[model samples]
Target: MDLRALTLLAGANSSGKSSVMQPLLLLKQTLHEDRYDPGPLKLDGPNVVFTDAGQFISQVAVGQRPRFEVSLGVGKDRGRLLYEPSAAGVTLSETGVSVGQAPEIIMRDGSVVSARETAVLLELPGLEAEGKNSIASRHGIAHEIPLVPWVSIAVVDGVLLKGSVEFPAVGWKTHLSNDLMRLIHLGGHRGNPSRRYPRSVSSSDLRPGVFHEQAAGVIAHWKQHDPASLDALQSAMRTVGLGWSIEPVDLDATAIDLRIGRTRETSRAARDLVSIADVGFGVSQSLPVLVALIDAKPGQLVYIEQPEIHLHPRAQVGVADLIVEASRRGARVVIETHSEIILTRIQYHVAKGTLPPKDVLVHWFACDPKTGDTTVTAVEPDAAGAFGDWPVDFAEVGERVDREYIEAAWKRQSGEAG
Candidate 1:
């Protein structure tokens, strides 16, 4: 799938929306654990776990090979990893790497044959000597050779690579790798509401699906080091009509308490603090999402599943606005949601020109009744935020219910009058 600056996945349960995210999460976990070599892809990890190959693969046909492919990057500077199920593990079948604005270097199966072919196709001079030396050095065929500064060769075993390559003056390899490494995902089932949170050292990287457990610690760390971030989070909460500020109360060095202070005008004192559990459930449910978005740094990709959960319709729209603000601040945001309010808010933002239409993408997933396969259709919005051909049965259940109630009420009134 082609991901834009902001992508929204909307569909029914088991319609394959989460299926798109599972493989990427698996890859992220594998890369994070540094276990991407000499094995089939690791199915069980800290972030996610699968029992076996049967559970991981879909649409199984007897005697047919099971495989998955992931393609990333943009334009000529792109990479693709192909995998096949193996008894020992998931094995990497092949890899395709392209760099430079014009496809200068190509590596397939950890060999430089594609590079030589690319050189021949482009008719680049001095490639025969430079390409051979680079490939020899990468494969350990040569200990030392005069290397070309513009061209570099690298090898991959499975999905792991040992070295870095530079694309002339571009340095696309490092840039692309860094982008991939910055991916962050928050699962649908987030941390539950608790009275006290543990005080632990904050890591530079946020853990997937554990934002709730880390919220208090991250808040305390930022409160001490980066007060502006805390202020931003408070501002977002206010925007969502929460009208409360969050503070971390140290129970001791080992644990901290999260206290919510009233921010709205009231007869009581403004400094009065209450435990998060004492407040509405939506407050605790949305705290992590607000903190994550406001804390996002530039060029980071943030994935949030069901941000609208436990929120009122108005609050859901407010969360949508927060997502847009996060995107505007230079972070890429992807969300999966079932709330029509959130979708309507997004359309409003696009139509009012608060956000560019091209940067927003909406995908509607549906399952084929006969084949039991999932199909995705792109729902495009124009400059006016109007979508042509809305997806079938998208948020129509409420209207149907209302219609049924009105019909029954009319029949009862007619029978009584007769």
Candidate 2:
């Protein structure tokens, strides 16, 4: 699925919204193990862990091989990798590379190659001969030329042969690889509120869902090294209507204490700081999310699941503003949420021109009862803040409850009159 600047995945439980994100997380984990020799896409690793192939694959057709494909790109250049489960690990089957339109290269042998072919030949090792022959057969060209550096292509007789080709350097791939290294994912079930958060010098990226485990440490690190980040974090917290501020207290060299500050009103003096445990559960749950967003660097992607958890309706709406602001700053954001308030706020932002409509994309997922498989449908918002083909059942419980209340009131009045 193609992702925009800000993408939302919304659906009921068991509707496969998370399925779309699993493969990418798996790839990130695998690449992290060894970027150069990452043998197979890992099902289990530092980012995510799946039990086995059966659990990883969505649907297994009878007598059909199970596999998944992951494609990534930066700007116009694109690359894809096909993967299948093997006894040892996930195996990469095929690779495809596409470089945007570039001038055709002419070899001394009179053979020509397109920019796309040149990219593929350079990326895949030992494919130069096959690539050259295919190009020659398609073009019906013949020439006798030896492989040489800076030569685009060579041919001998009717068959094309491998030649030293200087491929255009594309920096997007390296940038994409670096992005994969620093990817941050926060899962739906996050760490529960604790009295204190432990400190770690090595924990740089936020862990899946367990971000709360390192929340205080992250804040402390930024506070000491980059205090401006704490300002950004506090600004985000205030935007979410959480008046409290966060500060880290050194318990020891190995541990840090997280303290919550109470905002003072115009008429009141400054209030004393309190332990994070003393605040509401929602504050604790949202702290890590805000911290992660504020700390994200430009071009880095942050994936958040159910960020509205434990938040009030207004706070949920506010979180949408945070997501939009983050996207506007060049940080890619992918969110999976069931909160209508968040969706409504996003729609409002698009309608009001706070965010461009093209930059926002929404995917609704549904489950097939008979097959027990999940299906995804794309829903686009118009300039008027209305979603075309809005699902009738989505977030309809409030309306249903209102109808039930009206029915009960009518029944009571009739019985009293009778």
Candidate 3:
């Protein structure tokens, strides 16, 4: 329904997940520049053919002697191409086709026009006339604007379609590279990367001065939306079943120290201080990402990999609820996940009317090692509360473990009889 938001392209590892994402990114590039040679095409191999002549001609503009036009369709929008007559030969970027200088063309609007946008239009090869261009004979024309590029982060250990963003004019597909850059550029954003939390202030928390501005943005977000009342935060923590009481504290201009209760007496009033690493893997991994999601503005698509890793069953369920909260608040979330606990929790919330089922759908990816292919199925529940097509190979490792246990039980029964 909200097509731009959360959509999962689920398939097991090496099952063409990245293959799908790459082409979409290349299509986005085509919107700005006209059709390019297959050699330069980022998505497919050089020999791959994308479009034919009929498709090419339709994209051309038929107007004044030298003007050109391009027409195509993507999703719900029909792309209109228009080019103008110029002293220097006019070039249509879509098809990489160019006509002599100063040829006038009639626009789709029935108005005579000229310029680069038109060049972009005429170059689109929806249907091209024969002998259209040198490249057309070698490589067919390509139409279609790349809306948003796809980015995959790990949902557990495999790829998940976190979210997609439309290109500028359209917009850039900024989900993966941009966000990763933000974190990387923050420079010295070390928060106990050693996977060990210190009892007191340590060297890991000491970041360089260069991170001041970026750290400021991070701290501001916590102060703005995190609960003001320590009690409220504690209650929220309890609801998620985490035993710790967390309070936000300003560390410096760019950092907020999260204090958790330590002792029984002071624990009532004093929040426990934690080395980010000392916490459970789930808390450290999910918290920073959740913080990022809350900080994002509406219309931003947040692509997150498996948010369930290392989390307990209850925490997995809580993360599902958190995702619902983010979606309701207008941040679109596209997540890749494998935890059945997370899946069950989402269904439970939907059934209880905590979240609308229509707004969310679970896609299951089952990999078949025999064929070396992965099959994708929608995992929506029916009235019977069972997934429609539960592939036998959904979790190969689990299946193996179950088989071993059954065999062991059979052996024990035979031994007892003897």
Question: Which candidate wins on TM-score?
Answer: 1
Measured on C-alpha atoms, candidate 2 has an lDDT of 0.67
Candidate 3, residues 1-418, lDDT tens digits: the string is 1233344444566564333333223333222232443222222322112332231122334653444443332233333333333232222222211222323222222211334434443354342443123222333223122211211111111111122322122211233322322221111121332222222221222221112222324433444544443344354455555545554556655355555444346635554565444566445445544444444445444545566665677777776777677666665566666665666665666677666555565555566788655566665555433455565244566778999999999999999998
Tens-place lDDT digits, model 1, residues 150-170: 322122244234333322424
Per residue, candidate 2 scores C-alpha lDDT tens digits across 1-418 of 7677788999889888888888778766654553344444556665577756767765777899898777776676565655677675555554444446533333322342344444434454343565456544453333323332222111111122243333233554455555676677878766667666777733554243335566677798888888898988877787787665777888877887777777745343235667777888778788878877776766778888999998888788778888888888878888999888888898889989988888888888889889997778887678877887666365588788889999999999999999
For candidate 1, the per-residue lDDT at 132 reads 48
Ranking by TM-score: 1, 2, 3
Q: lDDT for each of the candidates?
A: 0.69, 0.67, 0.41
Please report the candidate that would top lDDT against the real structure. 1
Model 2 TM-score, all chains together? 0.78
Cα-based TM-score, every candidate: 0.82, 0.78, 0.50
Please report, as a residue range, the 10-residue window in candidate 1 with the lowest summed lDDT: 140-149
Of the two candidates 2 and 3, the one with more favorable TM-score, higher being better, is 2
